[model samples]
Target: MRDLDETDVEILSLLATDARRPFSEIGERVGLSGPAVSDRVTRLEETGVIEGFTVDVDRTKLRGGVPVMVDVDLAVDAGADSDSEPLEAARERLRDANPVEHVFITAEGDLRFYARVEGRTVREWLSGTFEGVPVDDWTVTLVDEVEWTPSIDGVEFALTCAECSNTVDSEGETARIDGEVYHFCCSSCLSRFRDRYQRLEEGA
Candidate 1:
């Protein structure tokens, strides 16, 4: 993996702020031709340096439910590693849990769970998801205030549709073209991707 130069960083900055920014406009500011900038951005996407482009939407304006946090400590069997059979089974159950947005495991093998409170209380989430699961102990805390889709570290989080450049959901359809996977959130995006791929292959 090659380290990004200043030019790459500048390109990322512009795109992160405005995923819809034209390549020509970016080139004008960054002192590069349209094609040059296009090639660099394509390379960045292909290399996974840039995940995807997204828009910032106010969660309060949305109709989704609030967030809740749950902490679960599973029972550890004697003479077993962290990835023991019981833990793996519990993990599988958690994956199928309703409204579970995120789950993180601590160094002590305890789980930190984040879930959506869609007409259900934090205790309800615990009862629904963690019930019947073998656990040493568990606790629930309602997140009174929180930030959804917070910025990653110091960088902005944005994911643009690779085909049409429209801001799309993180959980979208994906396709593998010539061993390179591309994300598409709609049929229009898939059509655009197919057309572009055909053109590129024909030209090649």
Candidate 2:
């Protein structure tokens, strides 16, 4: 798959706002045609650039609770050659926990994970999970929210406007053609692409 550029970023941003938005509507906003926008979107999904769209369900309504970060300093056995075994085992245990949202390994050699907790399970997970071995220390801190979004900068693209040879910023504006999303610096270039696109369609 090709690298995602500014246009891809913009498309993702638009979708982020409204997942159900029509590709043609997104194209009009970004200066791309419906087919072109649709193609890029498909590419994004195929390449895993766009993981999967999700609905913003109200957690409180579903199951009320507080979100917290669990910081666990894994206790590797003294003189043990590797902690990988214990770490993986612990991760497997956490996987069964429905509250768990994300898990990550920090550079400082600790596991930082986020999960929602309610009633007594919070205390149980905080202690019972790492009781006998493996964890050196652990702490749970309540968090207001958890958001994980990534931005790819200056990602690879076709590089220039098909209309004016102007350099395109994937973040700027866009026009899609034959399923390819084209980025533009402004409306004028996008307009140029739009005009050419209509003619091409009419001719076709």
Best by lDDT: 2
Deviating ranges (above 4 Å) for candidate 2: 1-64, 131-133, 153-204
Residues 158-191 of candidate 2: C-alpha lDDT, one tens digit per residue: 4565665655442234434565656554345566
lDDT of 2: 0.65
Tens-digit lDDT string for candidate 1 (20-118) = 999999999778999999999887777766666653332322224456687777777677655466566667676665456567877876678776666
Model 1: CA > 4 A from native: 1-63, 79-83, 119-125, 148-154, 160-204
Provide TM-scores for the models: 0.43, 0.42
Q: What's model 2's lDDT at 90?
A: 79
